[model samples]
Target: MERVGLYPGTFDPVTMGHLDIIGRGMKLVDRLIIGVAVSEAKRPLFLLEERIEMMKEECGKLEGPGRAKVEVLPFDTLLMHFAESVGANVIVRGLRAVSDFEYEFQMTAMNEALNREIETVFLMADVRHQAVASRLVKEIARFGGDITSFVTPTVKERLLEKYRK
Candidate 1:
C-alpha cells in the first residue's frame, strides 16, 4: 500500500530547515502533503496565499528518485481532520532542539489520542539549521537584519519586501 505523509506547519515563511525535513521525509513516504496552517493564533508576516505560493515554489524544486508526490494545501480546521481528509497516515515534524520537544510531545500524544491510525514521525533538524526558526527569522527581518541565509530565495525576497514595506 502507498504511504502518504502529512507535514503541517504555520510556515509563515518556509525555512531551509523546513525544506530539509521535507526532503528527508519524502524518501520515507510515497506521497508528502505540505499542509500550510491558516490559523489566526499567530500574526503572520506573509498572507496565507503568499505562504502557500512560496511553499509550492520551494517544494516544486524537489526532484529525484526518492521524490514524493508533493502538494501544498491550506488548512484552518483541526489538524487531525486535515490529515484524514488528505488520507495521510503519517504526520511528519521537525525538532530543532529539546525546547521544542515538550510541545511536540504533547501535540503528538494528543493527535494520537484523537486518531490512533495517524502516526507522528519526528525528524531532527540538520546541524546547520539547528537555530533557524520562523519567529526568530521574522523578528530579525523586522529589525532590518538579513535573513537570506534562513529561508529560500522566494521566501527571503518576500520577507525583505514585507519588512521594507
Candidate 2:
C-alpha cells in the first residue's frame, strides 16, 4: 500500500524550519500533504489563502526524484479527520524542544485515542532551525530585525510586505 503522511500546521508564514521537517518527512512516505490549518484562534498574520500559496511556492522547490509527491491544502476540522481524508498512514511533526514535546505528547495521546491506525512521527528540527518559530519570526520582522535566516527570500519579502501595510 502507498504510504501517505500528513504534516499539519497553521503555517502563517512557512519558515525554513517547517521546510526542513517537510524535506525530511518526504523521505519517509510515498506522498506528503502539508495541511495548512485554518486557525482563526492564532490570529495569523497571513490569510489562509496567502499561507497556502506561500507553502505551495516553497514546496514546489522541493520537488525532485526519489521524493514523495507534495500537496498543500487547507483544513479546519479535527487533525485525525484531515489525515484520514488524505489517506495518511503517518502524521509528521517537528520537535524543537522539550516544551514542544510536552504538548505534542499530549496531542499524540489524544490522537491515538481518536484513531490508532495512523501513527505520529516526530523529527527533531535541525540545530540551526531550533530557534526558529513562526511567532518569533513575525515578532522579529515586526521590529525590523533580519529574518532572512529564518525564512526563504520570498517568505521574508511577504512578511516585510505585511509589516509595511
Candidate 3:
C-alpha cells in the first residue's frame, strides 16, 4: 500500500511557503498530489488553469524521495473525494499562524468524519516565509508594492501583467 498525500489549496499564486510545505510533505509520502481547488468564493487572482500551470512549473523543479512522484491536479469537488480519487491516505495542510488553526481544525475534523481512513497532517510554515500568502501578495501587488519576494518569478510576472491591464 503506497502512502500517498493530498495537499489541497486555492493557490492563486503559489508562494514560497506553499513550496516549503510541498517539499516537506513529499518526504513523508510515496506520492504527493498538489490539488488546486476551484474556489469561486475566494475570487482568486489567477484563474484555475493559470494557477495549475504555475504550480506545475514550480512542482516540476522539486526532486522528492526515491520513487516519490509529485503531481499537480485540479479539483472542484469535496476534498475527500479528491483524496480518494488520488489514492491519498493523508491530507497535508500548512499552518502559518494561530488564526488558521480554527478553520483547519474544523476541516480536519469534518474530513475525519467523512473518511476515518484518511488522516490530516499539518506543517508549520518556515518562520521566514510565515507571512507570505496569496491574498496578501495580491493586495500588495494591487498597490504596486514589491512582491518579488512573495511569489516565484513566473507568478510575479503574471501578477504584474494582470494588474497592469
Candidate 4:
C-alpha cells in the first residue's frame, strides 16, 4: 500500500517554515499532497490562485530523486474528508510552540473522532523557523521590514507585490 500524506494549510504566502515541514514530511510518505485551504475567514492577502501558484513554485524546488511526489491542490471542506478524498494515510502538521500544540491537539482529537483511520503527524519546525508565521511575515513586510529570511525570494517578491498594490 502506498503511503500518502496530506499537509493542509491556508499557505497565504507559503513561508520557509511551511516548506521545511513539507520537505521533511516527504521523507515519511510515498506521496505528499499539499492541501491549500480556501480560508476566507482568514481573509488571506493572496488570492486562492496566487497562493496555489506560490506553493507550486516553491514546492517545485523540492522535487527530485528519492523524495515523495508532491501535489498542490485547493480544499475548503472538512480536513478529514479532504484527507480521505486524497487517499492519505496520514495528515502532517507543523508544531512551532506550545500554543500550536494546544490548538493542534484539539484538532487531532476532533479529527480522530471523525476518522481514526488517518493519523496526524506533527513535525517540529526547524529552530531557525520556529518563530516564523505567515501572519507575522505579512506584518513585517507591511512595515517594510526584511522578510527575506522568512520566505524564499520568489515568495518575498510576490508578497511585496501584493503590498505594493
Candidate 2, 45-162: lDDT as tens digits: 9999999999999999998999999999899999999999989989999999999999999999999999999999999999999989999999999999999999999999999999
Model 3: per-residue Cα lDDT over 19-59, one tens digit each = 99998998889989999999999988789999999999988
Tens-place lDDT digits, model 4, residues 1-165: 999999999998899999999999999999999999999999999999999999988999998888999999999999999999999989999999999999999999999999999999999999999999999999999999999999999899989998998
Tens-digit lDDT track of model 1 for 1-165: 889999999998889999999999999899999999986878777799998999999988985786898999999989999999999999999999999999999999999999999999999999999999999999998898888889977788888888777
What is residue 141's positional error in candidate 3, in angstroms?
Answer: 0.8
- Show the lowest summed lDDT stretch of 10 residues, model 4: 57-66
What's the CA error at residue 55 for candidate 4, in Å? Answer: 0.5
Q: Can you tell me which runs of candidate 4 are displaced by over 4 Å?
A: none
**Which run of 10 residues does model 1 get worst, by summed lDDT?**
60-69
Which pairs of residues collide in model 1?
none
Residue 44, candidate 4: C-alpha displacement in angstroms: 0.3
* Candidate 3 residue spans exceeding 4 A from truth: 64-67
Backbone atom clashes (below 3 Å) for every candidate:
0, 0, 0, 0
Order the numbered candidates by TM-score, best leading: 2, 4, 1, 3
The Cα local distance difference test for each model comes to 0.92, 0.97, 0.91, 0.96
Task: Please provide TM-scores, in order, for all candidate models, with all chains considered together.
Answer: 0.97, 0.99, 0.96, 0.99
In terms of lDDT, which candidate is stronger, 1 or 3? 1
